[model samples]
Target: MSKPYSVEQPERSAVDAMDGIVALEFGADWCGHCKAAQPLIQAALGAYPSVQHIKVEDGSGRKLGRSLRVKLWPTVVVLRQGQELARVVRPADEEEVRRALATAD
Candidate 1:
């Protein structure tokens, strides 16, 4: 049961993995939307425990989030080999998260 890690800069190997689902969760711990989405995100990703979930502490100073053009908290970016397949911001529906996961398969 690995949860997301609050790292400032994510590693290239983690992001650019040529295989498997890598979910970059950009958000702040204090954000309400981020907090609310956690449960749903977890549940949605529960089916795919192998998926790499990286919780980044995004803010004005977090360059990675800005580089990814993340405008909202709890922005989930599903990637494979560092290529973005899909993204969801402030997702209220579990389906959206599931959709992100499906991209890996």
Candidate 2:
């Protein structure tokens, strides 16, 4: 909710080097599925305020998304100390996101 999906995406290396809890949200602003899930994502993220959320705009030729093997809109990849902890793609509700975030704990 604090930051919108940004076109200026970070390099895969930077993301992989991040420490602590990180939520990488891969999606395009124009994506309907991404738009629809914003509220749900926001609500779930609210509980994990310490988690770093980076909304990356994903599409063809986007190295970060490609490296992560993102094939759908709003793919939320939770990472702990630069390693993957959990992933939720096209989440249907806030619970799905919350559950994914819970893995960090």
Candidate 3:
């Protein structure tokens, strides 16, 4: 089973300060695109056990989402040492997600 998006999100500053490779997946549980991408995201993430993945619940008035300018569902922003390396929005397949994750490698 896939994990549900968490409403308790870390501040953008905190995220920006994070160390190592991190995957910030911004989406909502009710979003179809988000749901469809879960498996692909998980499969790709499995190959990179060192990577930290944070599933964030996003919607209107969500500060983290707003600050990140997340306007779409299932935006996987891959970061390396707190800096953005790549992003894949609404990935169609595991390979797409893997490609985004590859940037941090």
Candidate 1: give the clashing pairs. none
Name the best candidate (by lDDT): 2
Q: Which scores higher on TM-score, 1 or 2?
A: 2
Off by over 4 Å in 3: none
- Kindly provide the TM-score of model 3 when superposed on the true structure, using C-alpha atoms: 0.94
Question: Which residue ranges in model 2 land beyond 4 Å of their true spot?
Answer: none
Supply every candidate's count of residue pairs whose N, Cα or C atoms clash at under 3 angstroms: 0, 0, 0
lDDT of each: 0.82, 0.91, 0.90
Q: Check candidate 2 and list the clashing pairs.
A: none
Candidate 3 differs from the real structure by a C-alpha RMSD in angstroms, to one decimal, of 1.0
RMSD of each: 2.5, 1.2, 1.0
| Residue-level error in angstroms, candidate 1, position 46 | 0.3
The stretch of ten residues in a row with the least summed lDDT in candidate 1 is 1-10
Per-residue lDDT over 1-105 for candidate 3, one digit per residue giving the tens place of the 0 to 100 score: 398999899988889888899899999899999988899999999999999999999999999888878899999999876678998999999999999999886
Supply the global lDDT for candidate 3.
0.90
lDDT tens digits by residue: candidate 2, 6-35: 899888788888888999999878888998
Candidates 1 and 3, the one with greater TM-score: 3
